[model samples]
Target: MCVLKLKPAYKDYLWGGHRLVDRYNKEYDGEILAESWELSCHPDGKSVIAEGPWAGKTLEEYIRAEGKGILGENCRRFRDFPVLIKFIDAKQDLSIQVHPDNRYALKHEGQYGKTEMWYVVEAGPGAFLYYGFQREISREEFAQRIRDDTLTEVLHKVPVQKGDMLFIEAGTIHAIGKDILIAEIQQNSNVTYRVYDYGRVGKDGKKRDLHIEKALAVTNRVPLVRAKNSYPHVADCDYFTVDKLNLDGKMMDRMEGCVSEESFVSILVLDGEGTVACGKDGEQRVTYRKGDSLFLTAGSGRYVVEGRCDALVTTIRSQSAPVRIGIDIGGTNTKIGLVDVHHRLIDTVSIPTKTERDPEDVIADVGKAVQELLDLNHIPLDACMGAGVGMPGTVDRENGCVRYSNNIPWENVPLAEELGKILPVPVAVANDADCAALGEAVAGAGKDVSDMVMVTLGTGVGGGVILDGKIFSGRLTGGCELGHMAIYEGGELCTCGRRGCLEAYASATALIRDAKRAALADPDSLLWELCGGEIGKLDPEMVFAAAEQKDPAGMKLTDDYVRHLGTGIVNIVNLFRPEAVLLGGGISAQGTVLTDRLNSCLKAECFGGEHGQIPEVRTAKLGNLAGMIGAAALLVMEG
Candidate 1:
């Protein structure tokens, strides 16, 4: 059964009383029962399974055994368990303390910061707790009050009653009052900065240490205005969503819901005696009562609770879904997107590459774009799996370096290492063409196919090979330079210092060069009029447009271009024989007009002509967004 009833770990502190043992049925022989770590998986204190096949095992152990998928999709976004639930019994006034925010706590304490909510389970009459400052105070005055042992003078002490809920955000100076039994749900961290301890001494008769300087540095010195959030749940945050569940023995005996694969469910029973049933058939059951904690793994299917109970049900929400940041670096522009596990582009932004600057400067600009995209989507850095970047070059994927990029002036740049310093998550770098192929394979035109290749005929004939759904970059990550293959050896001087490479004839740049030569030679043709009699003003679109009109120069250039492109396609088909040959980039915008002619040429000249079906040549569906999306998919593929 996925549902687990837990045995809490107990803590004995000086300010604690035995109320938890007497009232909540907590089993502890210690003189002072301060807190019961009910649903914790923290290294310091983890709850054990009480009655099940997994009995005697810690929650952490059970999770490791069952696999993380049980934690559901939303909870998986967190690196560790997202929450800690506990019962706090304060016989005497607890220490006045505050917690640092994640930024400070993670830096100083190596853990998440605490943002807790207290539900007054049992509060004695005349009981009050310190919440925050009564009014705004200067830093000097706050320090003076702390030094004079009069910090409580400025504190807002709110009287508490049973069932009242108070949220204590990190950095809010607060203390639990005497004679209070509270159920606290907070971040999975144990960093506390004590402001005052009532001059209390420990068992050794020494005064407990104070964190006055740290508290002063982190505490909010302003008055905290009380506000309540309205949602279907009791409280919702990026970390967790909490809902209240109340069942009466007579009328409401059962409650049920499905725990989706996105997040695990946590049940903290405040007051209850019931059997929780979980599983597809609802046969798996575990008995629970007051002070009992239960954990239900994500995707546990259906769960039902029977008998009377007052409890808090916590689940990770969709907004906390794990995502990856994908960046596609072009010569002129860089595009970034926040892509969820499903390959959906939730949010995107584009920034100028500014490649004239140093590679580090360009990477810093990309990092800023990444941060802005995260902020726009309200996604925490921890929620992202990592960042993936695709640039035009021979990328050393293992070292995360760009070996060389002919279009962008980068050579042997450690792209990932430099970007990682600026971003919070891990960074991965690959060739931009390889990323587009991956994008098309996972989410675009070739998504359904197993083996496919993407050929982007933009500035150059850039393409990538996918074999059995994985990138087929050969040894040293250098083999998939499809454009450099010599289609006409010793014929035309190519950019790679080779003669008559595929890129020299089939690329948009190559087509433009051919068009310029043709325009100069054919002065009486439409190519001259289209370029306004200047050979430098020629473009691929003008050549194709004139060809559609059957202009002599246009038709001749189009036929030669298609023949060269078709020969390159036939070579790829005879080699790997992918399921689909996807065409992308600026030229692909011409759509079927380009594809149809290229298909005809392939059918006429391919090696296996008239014997077998040729690979379907289609325009890429993701167009300009393909590179970024593909880069994002690399995280999922590699992970």
Candidate 2:
């Protein structure tokens, strides 16, 4: 009931060729195949369910039978299905066109606006497309240029190749150039305002109609200059969020992910083939190749992709607009964030954590700070679902007690009970590492995985384990003590009075400590030069920087560090066998440098090696805010 395979509604536009029919295996009788509405619910052309008992049913019919609830809470905001996915083949130039915004479209056309993104599948040599105007032009000039047949002269032509992605907002004049094929994800509406046709005639021997006035009214006169930001999403806007995935078959051939209750998932594969399954046992599995569209209902929970392919995953990140509060307690400062149902961190505030003060006084200060945070965002105290706190040490989640926290240097603090007394809403407390791991599982690097282990290599090697979409905090003492696990038998003294623990060898503090020793030992080495010949000035980055420079001392330090960390991680893999091992904290910023080495190390040292499912090593996406957002989620998540 969760997974659905679709058969597209094909279109034979005048400018199209048989590329889709010939190369893409589109079952079409026409000579030209311009577009295939791969996963549509539009009345103009609906995609039919292509398999099982639903074989002959249109997607709309299937939705009507299943009820709209299957679309997830987020889709309830829209009047109909929010998105339409298709594959477009432009054998010749498509007409320069524009689409109206929602307001205009709803008012004049009674449909949603068109805001689309194009993922180039194939581009022949010298292929180019008109994006927008090169420079801002007046309405009079625009009209005159079209009348004079000089419109293309003013348009911004972009030379395109395979793999390029372009986001086209409504009202941006654009045209697909000849010999280009692409996958398009857009609003469900098909309201188009063809503005220019290059004097082409149809079967009736008449030029295509152009909505000049409507196009003028909606068209953005100013040149569109797309500004790229640092957000991880491919195309994140109010309507939809898109993410690209690739399984190269060697390094990655399988992807395991979870579909939360907030949004349904639409995966449109652009290249390669593989099995797409829902649930752990593959009950709703489909063996599909390229040009396939797979839909997973909301809360499908566990979905797997096993194949060599590049696909774009589209989902609605926002839910029904419920917001929750999250608090992350660190040694120096605490971060507070608002998490909406989309599992995204909406807003964040920070305050210094004066641990030297009385615990009750500090708790009172946190309450005051929470009120200030709500007031600043113009949110009422009762507006939030609840508040969740992530503490630095072992947290008794059920009893809301801080049993023992070496970082906060506190024991037996009733955090949840006290915070609840003031907040007037449900409050949940959890270990800081657990919160980070949960956040990653819910929305970050481990968002798609059911089983995940997050290791935070910070001041101490902190870790959390996620099993089947929930935190695995074993006992009241806060289990999954990943860092305390011994790496070397009685080799090094750990801060927790343990001998040869991972925390003593794998943490950033440990790295810096070793760097300082190496600097003192080798006064003439690059480690000393990077740390300015001062042993006390040595930091973790200085060690990695020296290693990046290929210094012998730095190489030795990094090699030993990775070896020690790798041994501990290998043990984690052999034990948990999670889909991914997410690395967080300041040290994870090293990106591929650290993960690449660890993956290689895991390959060599893991018990089964390549014969088993090797967990991919990736950097945690949410970064420092993971704890805060994940803490907020605890108020809504199942234990």
Candidate 3:
């Protein structure tokens, strides 16, 4: 008999009480729904299910068959089950959140920060989903709002439908609306902060203990600029990626083997039903239906998906290059970095831009910037090859010129030429969005494979694209001006003179605008604490830091940003099926809360439709220096 034992997810709750405890053991003396840790253990203390007829065997018996027996190598978690699963039923709102990237976690958290997807099996009608908040709020205004109970005004309120799948990342501020049931798939770890609860009393008629300090340490409040719709992905690589197999009747999707390493594919049924056929000889088919998920182990070549409705498929494989860097240049700050190929940071530096009158003078100063950077690191100019710059205006990469500097007042200036004049090697200049994308591609999370997108959260939202291992410069407007994508028709006015662009709701500029507006309405908020009681004194960085500090106002602001972020990323994942989507910028620096929400949004918004492939979402590996390193990488590759 085939004996594969599926494990049940464990839950941890602060509001947990002993009603259920009485059924299991009388020794339990804790609050209802207190702390739940799900573990799958057979007799003899084995934690995982074995394979074949011996799959249910205890740990001792499985080990006894080390060299023989059906249990084999697949029976052990140490040998198999590369992914971990969990479920969280938050009776109250989680803190404004953050998570370290994989590299950071390996060094800090001891386990991978969770990037989970939630399936809302049950939620109250009119239940609101807390994703990200809108725009950057000044630190002072944020503080003030908490005192006045006006922080809720800043969040993106989405009425979640049952059966909705939502992806949440670490660093993103999210709260499970009152009364919700969820199914979660994520990197295995339980780390959370309680930013703000609805002030609801638990069954004990007492307030739940809040992790305010830890919550503040993690939140990103600059407002998240969510990504656009993702198109179907034709290829994928490790860490993880999903592809849409929209089949009306029968369709055969041929996957051409690229490298030598083995690969795994996962199929998720979003609608109707379908069967996945193996590429090898026997042509085995695995049948699945809506909400069903299956995996293909160590196989390559053409696989067919045939069904009544559409199906979404995902693949995970190993690849070279694990880092990517993203860069964004604003009017006030100029940043640079060196990152590993996988979106993880190696080194970084930032400086205030001279922002002098003449474009030439400002461009000429880049030489000094490079020299100063080199001197600081004690590295010779000859040792470095190239650099990437995210200019403030439209950039003509072909001619290395800034077509127009709407934000800084420059036109057709050779910013790259001036910087190159000082450097020993070459340099590439692009719009801030393109530069951010390249940074993500080279050293950010989407390192190994091509075809990916990056979003940078800043004073203004920016976007970039990578296709087939090269930056895709849109035929005329540069590649993927995602920030400009419309979220609401004729909603908020943007600096670009457009209405309801994603930037209007999710950028630092938007956050500040809303925060200031909220402060104007509520004068008693804690926001006044950070800004000396003056709304004008508010700063984006200050608000972001405060959010990490978990001030009520800060948490509210971050929560709003995360909600909008979820909506935007869902759209992007639906449009392009890239291997993975990465988030960067000042906002993403806060970490897991943002990443967790992003993963949740993908699952909630994904629909099998005619085609239903959803991509993986992750935070940028590099913190603030992705662009500088990515720019440098551009030179290295061109050289």
Candidate 4:
């Protein structure tokens, strides 16, 4: 339902020619037409919606109005629109330049770095462009050559022709030569460091500026190896995948494909004319000719391009690739998993958590474990979208710090910042309980429901609340403490010095405590035999097992435990009224036995009982891996 035709913004630079305006039919009166920002959301030049109800608005505004989901699941990983497409016509050679990578750009330029690919639309005979160095050169020699204006002498020049594709990665010294028309697809960044400008003068009659120092720091001073990309698809990378579409009026007059929910489709018309039909019924049709650009929202169903044309179709592929690292930092161990956009756990690794060591040492070990996991799985650090850490206790998710962690001996620890220093990707930190809830909501049992609550009946009854498919951490990232809610006033003392907290009576530890006391009182009970007559060895599992055998004492303990837990569940249902109440942790392994009893309790005691549909009580499907998976989901949700 969301289809957009974009109008490009024109750019006129001193080295530009009028080919784009004269040949491509770009509307411009400038003496030189440098580039046409055909599809862009960058602040420097945003393309406007050429037609539709949202006409006259910028592409960014349209995306904001429609919600980013229309961009598709793949774009979910990016905080901003990932790609920028432009048509460039060089009348004169551009300055020798290099672009910094994300790490360097973010630090020095406060923006993303550029990694571009150019598809030569047309090139004059004997025309060539710089790619990299012709041979390996020392840093000193490179700098000397730049200073002496002999940098081009050592640069590798590749002759271009119609339909030639050149992929220019970040940190590669390159320049666009004269008499060449190029279609460039690149990251949504404008940071370029120029090394040599050939003493060209701008309109002001002053020599253009040079960023030699910064360029030298980032550029690769070595021979540029030419490699051929796959056919049909000229270039593919983390940011965008581009495919060439050449249809003559005979053999291939029409191209058809379903734009899946995974990524949006972008078509840039290079030549000829066509009618693009899209939507569920394919009723919406638009006439596109040379220089026309069209955007189809993700999950648009089916589309068809008919007529003779040479175009480039670019789509995002974030889902099919492994892009995120999920880390669950428990008290005893740290678990890491490589997760793809589809929520599949490709591989996982575990490392012991030496909580007794210094925080710095622990972080270093965690970083090392991550590196080992990547190396073992044959994944490059750059390929990882980002890293998410789920740690026990209160965490400042906004600041990526552990406000306080009783289990890990950490207080106000900058966990994300520390780990980011050692890892190539960005780092995010959150409460383990929150991560579990988010994980369930995204890829586990709660995937079918948008609103739900996860109550982890573990050592301390940790839990998280999810609202509208996002973790509800409340104000200051501390509100979702489901275990601390009071259930019985002035009763058992809680670990927080509070009376009758849910954790005091409903947690696994609480259940075990009660079971031990009961066994001590009734020595003939099955609980005693299950624990080998040793009261200290009694656990919640033994008590549940005894109840399953219809033992009186075990029945009583089970009933009381269920009643207390059900009371807590009832309170949550009455308060949030979520679509589902997911039970997690060790106790949840009991499955149906636990869920059936809890459902009964909810029917008997919850508000509005016996009327309307209550939340579905289910066990967490992800189990112990929930926290790690949820941590990875944070990158997508937050972005």
Q: Candidate 1, residues 318-389: lDDT per residue as tens digits?
A: 653368999999999999999976577999988999889999999999998898889888888888989989
Give per-residue lDDT, candidate 1, residue 42: 91
Q: Give the alpha carbon lDDT tens digit for every residue of 1-639 in model 3.
A: 211222232233553334324332222344544322222222212333323455455433443554322222222222333333323344545443444444455456565554555556456667667776686776566556655767678865667776666656555666666555444444445455555665756557888656554445455565655421223443232333445555555453332222112444444444556555654642555555554444443424455555664444444434323332223456877775644432345556666776755876765555666566667766566545456677767788877788887768787787777767766456677776665566667655776557787877877787676776667767785447778888889989977798988899888888888778766665765667778887887766666666777666766776777777777766776676677788777677757767877777677776673366567777777555555656645543431
Candidate 2 runs further than 4 Å off: 1-321
lDDT for model 1 comes to: 0.87
Candidate 1's error at 311, in angstroms? 28
lDDT of 4 by residue, 1-66 (tens): 556889998888899999998889788998999999999999999999998778899999988988
Superposed Cα deviation of residue 525, candidate 2 (Å) = 1.7
Off by over 4 Å in 1: 1-321
Alpha-carbon runs more than 4 Å astray in model 3:
1-7, 10-54, 57-108, 117-125, 137-153, 162-167, 178-185, 197-209, 233-239, 244-262, 268-279, 283-291, 300-312, 317-386, 389-396, 399-639
Count the clashes in each prediction.
8, 2, 119, 1
**How many steric overlaps does candidate 3 have?**
119
Q: lDDT per model, in order?
A: 0.87, 0.87, 0.57, 0.89
Among all candidates shown, the one with the greatest TM-score: 2
- Per-prediction TM-score: 0.53, 0.55, 0.44, 0.55
Error of 1 at 50 (Å): 18
lDDT of 4: 0.89
- Local lDDT at 236 for model 2: 75
